[model samples]
Target: MLIPSAQTGLQKALLAIIAAGGVAPAEGADDSYIIEEIRAVGPGCPPGTFDFDAEGQHFVYDEMILWHPDPAGRTVQYTNCLTTIAIDVAEGIQVSVAHARARGHATLDPGIVARHTMKFFFAGDPSGAMSHTELTGPFDDDYDLSGQLSPGGEAWSTCGEPVVLGIDSSLQLNASHNPAGTAELSVDRLDMKIQARRC
Candidate 1:
């Protein structure tokens, strides 16, 4: 009997889930979307921790969830594309589309848009199947930082107060923009708790 490797098994599982129709475009979607969940289990790797090829900007995980917005007003759903999820120990998280069919296609890379001086924390728990993330930066007056967790979840706050939104089984809280675009807001901070399941 031919046994599947751990990586292969995980990939098969992810593909199955994707085929089940979990991915869809968010309502009134835009050009970009954020990562909603990430989960993985493989040999030689911890439950929540996945292998990261820094030079290639590739991430290998058992499973992951992404919030994709359809500019054409289609339904929002999870994606299984080979995307890039980059995180800096001292910096913030950057989710980019490595393929055209994936979410955030043609969108600005969060890493590029994010200010280097920002401070944040991002981590996942395989045991609990959840990820906790937080970040803070200076509010940009030129562009509006408002966003939504899901299709119709809620508008992300640009005020110095914590703005919270629910993405799948995760909760994201952001407080780093000035609605009025007047003061030099501190981009208070954004916190998120994402839950994922092993396939």
Candidate 2:
């Protein structure tokens, strides 16, 4: 993870915390279409809490950043590719974490004011090969995010804020991107219950 040039330890602290937080993009303007944004919730440890010094572990990852200027003077666009390979505190610590990548973009009012949406993508859940963990596919859409879903029940709702599906099951996390373009999605938690475990 690339450390942000934030002033003050507390500011840096919060940025680190939010690095793994599940904050979605807030509402936007009339013509705006959120390509992607922060996750409202998920299971990856807080975004910026990588060092885990308190836990006595350290991990490093790769991040790709692209900056493109648009014709319009109002917004400067950017594309960010985040790739992470984590090393559990195995020798002394025990943390079964996963690697993740987020290749997304944003058109923003740059410099001091950042209005952007950042999407996240897993390499694919470690248990994805299993039948029980139908965690979804590349850009998993098994859980729907858009409020208005198609009645055909093509997929399940995963936006966390659940709707009754006859049975009461807490929602799950699913990743998706625009079929037409890129997007940013914020996920808060991915709670997995592996009762009958399989590799």
Candidate 3:
């Protein structure tokens, strides 16, 4: 999360990014937004394990991991994290999460499978979005999980008011019927694009 001292810097960067998209504001207009609060809960995202980068428009998680360490029997394990962010924006402006990317690593033996699921929505918006990616392997590798949102998938914030955005995610590993397989999956970071435009 960002402190008050960094608010000005974030505002400048955000404004520049928005302007680059051909949505420049009127001269001397200061329609900026700041992250007013962030709350993360779940075993996979404990206190001090998650933070947001205001300038990068991303969230970093240090401890989102799920492991199945036994190679003798079938097992199912899952880890989840839920995060809510409150953003205070200037009047006449609306914001939306235009894109999202997840970076992670996975080590799955033959017959092992893993899946990552995510849900994103605005607090008062009716049309939310859901995305999931699955991986099955016979080896170890790093993976970048990316997906395109459907038309109208972006949930816009209410004009001239603060908005709360929620992100809920989970990682699941299934080693069922695999008598000699082990698996491990870790999600390191979640990157997002916050777009601002006039309402």
Candidate 4:
């Protein structure tokens, strides 16, 4: 129930953008993307408890990227890149990652890791009065698969630290408007640049 009580200006702006069919890539451009930026007032779950204020705090989803290309020309990707949840507080914030399985997916055992499992949901009141969305996942941030077999049985490996395999995170947003609206989001920014060539 960590949803926003009211629709912030940022939400409205984002709704407008989506309603307008979202941004499109430039004609014949090598790459294209969209950014959703907004500020809103909401409660923050900082470690233990949730807090709110009369003067809404600032929240930004600057990581909302609609689409981008893999520099290696492997494939076209569409993703909601990243997000930043900010609340007005006097001290620094400490956030921790939970080790669990994503919804609608198999549970994570002790030794096995989840490479990339995510679950997102958006719901609204039947009367279209309020709406909210949530995103959760358990991705393995330390699962390495270098020198792994490709789908086509070829040698294809990535050179890097163990990226997300199975990880877990939770975020919820509820608005007192447009209960029928739907939204999708990602937890944080992911660096997808190719560091080495087929390492």
Candidate 5:
């Protein structure tokens, strides 16, 4: 059945169906939408900050995005993301992207790309509590993220945190604090150890 769509091409149509992940259609079948049209309605900005004294101190993020014909069969992507030092403020951020895994003779070097899609979770509080934040979609999914942000994803208050995250395999996160919003974060496994100063 070829339903008329305002968009072009057939791949996009099929992509929409398969992209549903596990979200089955409702009882009514008339509900119409687009694949890329599916947007994540969540927090616009990530809240809180990275406390070196508490949650470790430094952290790093990496991932890859590419076309995979088989979702269950293959996840062969060459993606990696990293951000500059950050703290518990609201300063600007800079991120870098590199290739982690690639197939064929092709390779994606750590260069300047654009926005990219991803899933992440963040939790903490410049105050005393904690908070949680999450992003569903509209992923820019770019490459080299010099000025890009890795989905900051969490903004809890005093007792919030990212729980039961349902996103891609990788996530990137960065944060700033204080009036100046300056800090440094490095990663060891999934633990970020921040070494920054807040005044």
Candidate 6:
């Protein structure tokens, strides 16, 4: 992992503990870098409701809920969150989003349906240079889903260039013919494995 320039030994230890079982493995490697910034937007992840930790390697969304009451009487409801992370790394390095996991809870009427979609990509990369996933159901309980980037599916950053990673996720609920029904979805945690290499 890339250590920040201003980080102290204690800070590095704390970050290591927090990032356990999370971030990608590349510790003690060259091309040291730091997460310059993380920007998030959308109704589900408004200001102060979502944040990045572990050196901007992990994301937490507190109150990322999409609720629709009386689906039959109302239009379909959806909520989305878009995040971008800027990484300041030494030149001659490349970065990639290797894996991702999403944990959430959903409550839907028997007839109602919901969809969870996520996409990971590097800024300025071709549209095809991205990882996407979609899962739908009449889910009624907690759920955990994960995705891994295959060898050929990896989206690498441009060698010797700045890296900006974008992650887009959404929860959409569709109404059924039921006269009175409610649908709700809450995304609690989202983890990503961001790896860097010497290119």
Q: TM-score of every model?
A: 0.17, 0.18, 0.77, 0.16, 0.19, 0.75
Candidate 3, residues 66-145: lDDT per residue as tens digits? 87764444388888877666677888888888778888999998888898877666664555666777888685988876
Per-residue C-alpha lDDT of model 2 across residues 96-192, encoded as one tens digit per residue: 2122222222232212122222222122221111011112122312221111111221222223221111100111222212122322222222222
Candidates in order have lDDT scores of 0.23, 0.22, 0.68, 0.22, 0.21, 0.63
Per-candidate Cα RMSD to the true structure, in Å, reads 20.1, 19.1, 11.1, 20.8, 20.6, 10.6
lDDT of 5 at 141: 26
Relative to the true structure, candidate 6 reaches a TM of: 0.75
Cα lDDT tens digits for candidate 4, 1-199:
1222232433443334334442222121111111122122122122222221222121223332211122433222233211122111112221111111222122222222222222111111011111122222222232211111112222211232221111112233221132232223233222211111223
lDDT of 1 by residue, 74-119 (tens): 3222222222122111112223111110111111112212211111
lDDT of 5 by residue, 33-74 (tens): 111111111121112211112222222232122332224333
Worst 10-residue stretch by lDDT in candidate 2?
Answer: 162-171
Quote the lDDT for 97 in model 1.
16
Better of 1 and 3 by TM-score: 3
Off by over 4 Å in 5: 1-65, 71-122, 125-142, 147-195
As a whole number from 0 to 100, the lDDT of residue 79 in candidate 1 is: 29
Off by over 4 Å in 2: 1-76, 88-114, 118-122, 126-199
Give the lDDT of residue 5 in candidate 6: 20
Clash tally for model 2: 30
